[model samples]
Target chain A: MVIDLDRCTGCEACVVACHSENNIGMSTPEEAARGRVNHWIRIDRYYEGQFPDIKVKYRPVLCQHCDEAPCEPVCPVNATYHNPEGLNVQVYNRCVGTFYCANNCPYTVRSFNWFDPKWPEPMQLQHNPDVSIRPGGVMEKCTFCIQRIKRVEDQADAAGRPVADGEVQPACVQSCPAEAMIFGDLNDPDSKVSRLAGDGRATKLMEELGTKPKVVYLEKAR
Target chain B: MKHLFLLLLSVALVVPCLRADQPILFPHSTHINKVHLKCIDCHISADTRDAATIPGVRKCMLCHAKIAADKPEIKKLAAIAASGREIPWQRVYGFEKAAAVKFRHGPHARHKVACATCHGDMPNAITAQPLVKHNMGTCISCHRQNNASDDCATCHY
Candidate 1:
């Protein structure tokens, strides 16, 4: 995934899209006040300067899906691990409510299910059937929309062809009105994501941590 | 010894009563053997979709409108078709939501796997019943033999 900071308007379409696509539980007003809102992708706001000369910057953050993931090793149950496709997968059934992985993660993206997810009346009907409604006591975060990836892969496999570039778009990438995010095979040299990763302004979120995150962020133009 | 015999007797008596009675006793043997209707003729989506859906009363009425119009079951089916209500057929095989198994019939059907492999000989049975037990082990074994993906995400999302 390549994110162009210059294009982001901080409208948060990606946040809403991620919630609906992943069947993320809604947080009530009381829960929200307590910082219990479950947002798989959230826009982090940074204010530079103060009083009349203020400038605001927005960075959309989610699971970085690190190559040397700190979360993977800390998971005692092996509930979280890197898959063959390079996705950091969380198996809800295998999870035993251990918060070790959440603690180790530098991005702080993993959220614990404090209560059983409930949807009032008609809201339950809106859930995406592809994503599981994670039960309480499990830790979940961004999967890069593995369900969507699987669907496209399955179709390609059935047709006896490789998944074309730009064929697999995560919910966040698809819903971004500004087209701020690009998702594709980073290994493919000609892929948009791969080309963007080689851009002069592209930088990793926290290069000092040595996490080797797959998401590349382009610097906001000065 | 007497108590053990009584317990065994009770289990034997109760086991056969477990199968729920359908709204209509659909005669699978008669339809397949005598009429020579293929399974996909009624389960239209089996070869191209996730669900091998149960045919609605309208599909049943297509032939029953003339062939067995006088039969009691046919009359009941026709009445359902006229009322424009579904038959409320009970599912004979399905995984629980908690299992998160997304079983698609299309790929399996296209692979040339016989319907009888998972469903058993449904055409020879008098009525629809769960003739085969489907568990993760059964699916894994089959996949292993066929050199198909046994990845956990393949079925469970």
Candidate 2:
């Protein structure tokens, strides 16, 4: 997935959609105060220049799902690993909560729950039946919506047709009001994501890390 | 001594029996079993990446609009639809906040494990049971036995 920072309105629709779809835990007011919100995809709010000329930038941040992910190597239990489809998949049951993967992540996208997340009686009804509610303590990060991708792939495979570019949008990408997020194969130059990634302003976050993240971010427009 | 023994046995059986009652009588048999509605019919989001969805009143109204027109239970759906209030259902199963497991049901369901294997016979079930253990041990063993990836981080956030 590639994000066009230029078009991001930072309305936070993507964040809310992801929370609802993925069953992301809600942090108590206290937990949020301590910076412990369990947001798989977060908009990195950045500020630049002096007040008169100051500019605010919102960059949606999550696991890069890198080709050479640093977290995958440091995992003592192999809780983190790369998949064939360029996803850095996380298996929750296998996680021992050692947090080695969290520490090793260059993007710091991984979040650990310190308490049992709760939803009041009726609110729980809204819980998505398709995603598991994560227990506290295990480390987690973005999987590029691996479940969604797998479903689309399986459907496509069954039909004997190749997966279409816009067919399987992740929650964030699908919910973006401005349609700033594009997801598709980077390997296919004809794909929208690939074309966007190749744009002159596109750059990988923390290129110095050499993690080779599949996610590409377009520079903020002046 | 016999009375005391009987008392102890009664408490052991009765006390826990009360706890076993679901917070709400969800009557899965009526909604799923007798009607033969798919589990995903009400929890429609399950077909996608979500789980345990509390369907909107409009969704319920589509059926209750005809099936139970004169019933009190049906009125609740109408009230909710009029007020645009989402029916809030308490979550039965989910990861403890500390476990941080990112368990997506779409992939698992897509992999040929019928919903009944994990959710039990919900269509015929009158009450919801904790049919699937969902503990780490249960999960890990299944994954290992099936050659599914057992990495701890796989499900953990």
Candidate 3:
């Protein structure tokens, strides 16, 4: 996914959409106060220049779905591994709740489920049946909206055609009101994501760390 | 309090037995053999919706309103329809909520898996009963057979 920071207003529509689509349970006020809150796609805001000449910039960060994902190697259960599609797939059932992946991650994007997700009454019915409701004691992170990826993949397979450009839009990309996020097959050179990644302004979140995350962010323009 | 606990425990133990005796004996044989209705006839969304939809009383009434209108079972269907409440049918096959399994019927139906593939010969069944365990292993083995992805996230996202 290529996030054009130039366009992001930090509306957090992507955040809200991810929670609903992925069945991410809510955290109480206490949990949030204790810093146990979960927001898979977080909008990191920073202010540049002091005093009245300040400028606030919002950078939306998610799992880079990195190629050289550090989390993959440390997993004793091989629960977190790189899939053929270059997506960092998390098998919740296989995860033994070891926080090694979270510790090793430079982005610190992965959130451990401190408790089983609870949705009272009709709120439970609002859950998207496509994605599994993650149970407690497992580390959860962004999977590029992998369930959405699988759905498109199955459709493409049935049609006997290559996944077209813009065929797969992760929840963040789909729900972004500002249209800041871009998702496509990176292997396809002609794809928008590839072209955006090739931009001079585009840079990895932590290039020095060498995680090689699939997500790239275009530098905010002056 | 002790008696209450014992009663609750007995009720919990007996619930499965009660479920075995379905509200209505579905008589899959009569529908398939005598009526010549396919499995998808009433379960119209079996190939489309996530779960093969259990037929509402309306779906049953579509045919029963005329054919076998006087049969005791048909009367039950009609009476249930008139009450404006859905049939209280227990689900015979499903993964637990915590298993985090998501099964779609469209892809499976498109793959041309027979009705008996996972469900056994439901047409010959007297009442709804799960033929396969639908465990992770059971699902994985089948995917292996078909050269489909058995990725944990495929079902257990």
- Report how far residue B122 has shifted in candidate 2, in Å: 17
Candidate 3 lDDT by residue in tens digits, A1-222:
899999999999999998888888888888889988887889999999997999899999999888899989999999898877677888887899999999888888999898987766778889887887788898898988887887887788778787889988888899998899999888889999999999988988987888888888998446
Ranking by DockQ: 3, 1, 2
Best by DockQ: 3
The ten-residue window of minimal lDDT in model 3 chain A covers: A116-125
Regions more than 4 Å wrong, model 1: B1-20
Compared with the true structure, what per-residue lDDT tens digits does model 1 show for residues A178-218?
A: 99999999889999999999999899988789999999999
lDDT of 1 by residue, B2-79 (tens): 999999999985553344466676888899999999999999989777778899888888888898799887787888
DockQ score of each predicted structure, in the order shown: 0.39, 0.26, 0.50
Q: Is the docking of candidate 2 incorrect, acceptable, medium or high quality?
A: acceptable
Across B1-157, the per-residue lDDT of candidate 2 in tens digits comes to 9999999999985553334354334567787657777878777756555354666667878887788677765676577678877765556577675455556665576666677767765665554555566777878887898888765435544
Lowest summed-lDDT stretch of 10 residues in model 1 chain B?
B13-22
Interface RMSD of each: 2.0, 5.0, 1.5
True contacts kept of 2: 0.56
Model 3 chain B weakest lDDT span, ten residues long: B13-22
Candidate 1: what's its TM-score on chain B?
0.86
- C-alpha positional error of residue A191 in candidate 2 after TM-score superposition, expressed in Å: 1.3
